[model samples]
Target: MTNGARDENVTLEALCRGDVRTCARLLTRIERGEEAVIPLLQALYRAGGNGRVIGVTGPPGAGKSSLISCLIGAWRRRGLRVAVLAIDPSSPFTGGAVLGDRLRMVEHGCDDGVFIRSMASRGQLGGLARAAGDALTVLEAMPWDVILVETVGVGQNETDIMRHAAVVVLLQTPLGGDEVQAVKAGIIEIGDVYVVNKSDHPAADRTCRQLREMIARGSRLRPDRDWQPPVIKTQAHLGVGVAELVDAIDGCFAHQNADPEAARRYMSDRARHRIGEILRDRLDRRLRSGDEGWLEGSIEPVVSREKDPYTVVAEMLSRL
Candidate 1:
């Protein structure tokens, strides 16, 4: 095995061969918030993207894990390698996650074609672990044909999936009009494919109808304006309709790639978002870096009303 610390090309080569041990170790280091992975990530970025990043997000008990497991099976049957990152809610005190999502995927444990890893959300907002993009950078460099990212089952505005994935699948269970109304507009705007899971439920069709109506009227803010988001129903646990779900996903990806204009626009938007994310994360670390004298110098004036916050912000921005 090549030493990733010394040779990023060698590491990239190993990763391209789907070196599971190396990938796992790198992800572990990244999840611990290590700074050492930066160069490797840079190399991977320059190496260019490989896998299709598919993001799955929905509310709690939406059977996202089960659906993902089934999707992995479907993709594997198509002779495609699959990787999954399941983001579990972390304990606030311990900064640890139970990783129960992994349990739901035990069926795929023996498959060499599939790799499943659970990441702690670590109190990060936007339904993902703070290290998600870093983790994704690692996976996207690997040999996987598809990389599946499952969120921590958060609410509407937290649809950070759009920033990372080329395709986003939003899941929902059967619901009445009122319950469907609770699915906020922000989430509605983010999904490239909407799914009504648990299709066996009595109100499933009604829920799908409501979703279509909402999707039809919401003025979808998607860059692929010529594309129409499809709504599919799946009984995931029974493995029913999963093939259709996969078909929809395949169709969505094809549609997004079909138009040269949409493809460029989407890529540009995603790059812009990634830049903003990196800037914010870097600035946040700098601010919270705990230089007592520098902090006291910055805060004292504001405390004494000698400096307005906006002016102080300008000063800090200039310094940073």
Candidate 2:
């Protein structure tokens, strides 16, 4: 083995032995795009199917963190080791997260049964998705029995989590407006289970009903599925209805894997995504450095509006 491989093996061995420091280091390396981590991922992937990956997505302040905390409690009761990849949106200007999603789960930070890592969007929507996968890979190398991905409640681009997770739980609040917005965002189709959180709120039932109606509409349009997504109500903080939510999550995983086509779509999306990410990184580097002659030439005219962006892009590609 090369020196890097030897070092990686040591790291992997430490991970398997439940060394949090080694695991954290490996995760950092993976985040930095260090190839030395590949062997570690390969080893973990080879050991395959070590954990159940659950994705929790919804609108902001929908109590997703509380629900996740409840779920972690549930899993912990079963004596399962859990890992959470909680993604927060980076500021458009500063690139730092506005709120620390991981901080909300600080109650479980010392559990030893749980590992929670806070991640920023990093300006790549796809990066959040891939980082979740990488985090899962590293956690899988350890003794984790379940992995949870908590995405920033921003609906757009967050669907990328569906590719990596075995089950997706869509959370929402009592606002009729948010339910309509969720439908418009196409989150309805991607959800395996729809959770109407904050059930103690007065509008919870109405929001639940609205989601059901939306599902009914989708059901009529897409009649091919044997199973339909179910809406469950919960007050996660009080732990009311958490059992049913867990059952729904289990059922969704069971149903999702039973369909080969669903698995195929996920695999295809993941494979294509990896390639696309590499190209995007390369292109971004090229553009930032002004290394490509075409981009260098097109910059001034496009900025000056002497040439439109569309024409400039076309000419640049043609030149390349």
TM-score of each: 0.90, 0.84
Best by lDDT: 1
Residue 167's lDDT in candidate 2: 79
How high a TM-score does candidate 1 get? 0.90
In model 2, where is the ten-residue run with the lowest total lDDT? 124-133
Clashing residue pairs in candidate 2 (N, C-alpha, C atoms within 3 angstroms): none
Which parts of model 1 have CA positions greater than 4 angstroms off?
1-7, 176-183, 219-224, 290-293, 296-312
- Tell me the tens digit of each residue's lDDT in model 1 across 1-320: 44765576677788878999989988998887777778888888776588899999988889899999999989988999999999989898987668889888889999999999899898888899988988898898888999999999866678788889989999989862464574566776778898999899999988888888777776454433866778899998899989898999999889878888888887898899888988898897786677557767878888899887898777667877
Query: How well does candidate 1 score on lDDT at residue 61?
Result: 84
